[model samples]
Each structure stands twice: as C-alpha cells, then as structure tokens.
Target: MSIIMQYIFNGIFDIYSIQSNYYFFLTNLQLTIIVTCTLWALCMGYG
Candidate 1:
C-alpha cells in the first residue's frame, strides 16, 4: 500500500512539473511572437 501511494504521489508530482514547464514555454513563445510582431509593425510604420 505504501509503495502504491508513493508511485501515485511521484506520478502526480511529475505531471505537475511537466505542466509548469509547458506553461512557462508557452508564455515565453507568446511573448517572443508579440515582440517580433510589434517590431515588424513599427518597421512598416502602419500606425
């Protein structure tokens, strides 16, 4: 019973870490895209 609980807890922790990393990666990607688009627009002087 203890071993099963340990495995379950470990799995949950792993999943949490994976999700955190994915969120961080996605936010970074979004920020990069936004910055790139803003720069492109500024260069084109569409404003």
Candidate 2:
C-alpha cells in the first residue's frame, strides 16, 4: 500500500512538473512573437 502511494505521489509530481514546463514554454513563445512583431513594425517604419 505504501509503495502504491509513493508511486501515485511521484506520478502527480511528474505531471505537475510537465505542466509547469509547458506553461513556461508557451509564455516564452508568446513573448518571442510579440518581440518579433514589434521589430517588424519598427523595421517597416510603422512604429
């Protein structure tokens, strides 16, 4: 029973870590897009 509980806890931790990583990656991607768009606008003499 204890071993099963341990495995469950480990699984939950792994899932949480994966979710955090995915969130971080998405945030970085959004930031990159924004920066790229801003640069493009500046280069085009719009901003």
Candidate 3:
C-alpha cells in the first residue's frame, strides 16, 4: 500500500536523478570537445 507507493516513487526519483546527471556529464563532455577543437583550429591558423 503506502510502502509500495513510496518505493515506486523513490525508484522513479532515483532514475530521474541518474538521467539528469548523465545528461549533464554528456553536455560537459561535448563542450570540452568543442572547445578543444576550436583551439586546435585557431592554432593551425584555420580560424
């Protein structure tokens, strides 16, 4: 009853948090890669 509902709610929350963290990490990684590429291009006189 209430315990089962609580467990379900907790599971959903855990999953949501994990998903958000994963997306955050992915965004940071993409930004880092883009910055690195841009710097490399500038160094090579392409920019």
Best by TM-score: 3
Candidate 3 per-residue lDDT, tens place, 1-47, comes to 99999999999999999999999999999999999999999989963
Every candidate's lDDT: 0.98, 0.97, 0.97
Better TM-score candidate (2, 3): 3
Error of 2 at 13 (Å): 0.5
Clashing pairs in model 1, backbone N/Cα/C closer than 3 A:
none
| Sort order, TM-score high to low | 3, 2, 1
Q: Write the per-residue lDDT of candidate 2 for residues 2-38, one digit (tens) a residue.
A: 9999999999999999999999999999999999989
**TM-scores of the candidates in the order shown:** 0.83, 0.86, 0.90
Q: List the residue pairs that clash in candidate 3.
A: none
Model 2 alpha-carbon miss at residue 23, Å: 0.6
| TM-score (C-alpha, index-matched) for candidate 1 | 0.83
lDDT of 2: 0.97
